[model samples]
Target: MSTEKVRAYQPETKPKRKQKQVKVKVTKKKWISTGEKYLYSVISGAMLCACAYVISFSSATDSLNRDIESMEGKIQEQQSVNNSLSYEAEQLRNPERILEIAKKHGLDIKQSQVKQAGTVSAD
Candidate 1:
């Protein structure tokens, strides 16, 4: 019987490679056209005018509400004065009030004898 010799095989290793760096150039771009620029300015001006109009409208509405409230207060005051005047008018129409006024003015109330009053008064 003959013995054969065995050879061990070694694993292969890969070589390391160097990485290359890339350079990028950045450039500025003009994205607006002349016609678009004019349109944008017009739109901005219109927006500003609209905002001003809204503010003015709100102020006017607030002023109108204040005026309405003031007018209502005046109407209430006038109604109270009218009621007071009406009560005074009613008091003036009373018989006691009329007698008091007559007494204050020094007018006299008279009583007469029946036969003498009848003889004297027809003319």
Candidate 2:
């Protein structure tokens, strides 16, 4: 039994592995040759350009809106000025005001002077 146990218990030996130097081959890639990569770059550039154009257009639209608002305000102000000027013109066209202005300008018309001026004088 001891001999059978000794024969069954043969010492274990580890297998030796050989180490070799491995060379890895790396390939150089051209900038335009890879289809998917080039396509991705082109699509990305197009997306960026589209975004920039949208941003610029939005900014221009905002500027135009602001200008429109400014013009509207100016138009309102001008309308108010025109209303006041029209009121002033109506007041100036009043006969009493015209008489006062003529008096201030040293132009006086007596009733006799009007009648004398109305009569035609034959020379």
Candidate 3:
């Protein structure tokens, strides 16, 4: 009974093995990868080009509108000049004015038959 009690109280005779220290490699993650950076750059460049195109198109449209307005003004001025010239031509074609001019040119006409010219249209 004494031997059984001493053996029960004795520790195990097995050699203790040392625990292996595992080295964990802690790698810091990059905020942006190389591929992501290139994609972002391409997108930004495309946006910039699009903005430039829109601005240039707007400027060209404004210039075209200005030119059109200037042409319209010129056309109106020309129309006014044509109207005055047409009025002067009608005054010159008056029958009374023609008779006065013919008399001043020493044209002796016993018959005061003044025929008005008319436009002949082929209908």
Candidates arranged by lDDT, highest first: 3, 2, 1
| Models, CA RMSD each | 12.7, 8.2, 9.8
Model 1: clashing residue pairs? none
- The digit string of per-residue lDDT tens for model 1 on 1-123 reads 223322224344678688797898987776997899999999999999999999999999999999999999999999999999999977867766666676799976563322212245655
TM-score per prediction, in order, is 0.56, 0.58, 0.70
Tens-place lDDT per residue, model 3, 1-123, is 799899999997998799999999999999999999999999999999999999999999999999999999999999999999999999999999999998899987788689877886788
| lDDT (0 to 1) per candidate | 0.79, 0.83, 0.95
Better of 1 and 2 by TM-score: 2
Tens digits of per-residue lDDT for model 2, 1-40? 6988997898867797887979999998776667888799
Candidate 1 displacement at residue 7 in angstroms: 38
Clash count, candidate 1:
0
Error of 1 at 107 (Å): 5.1
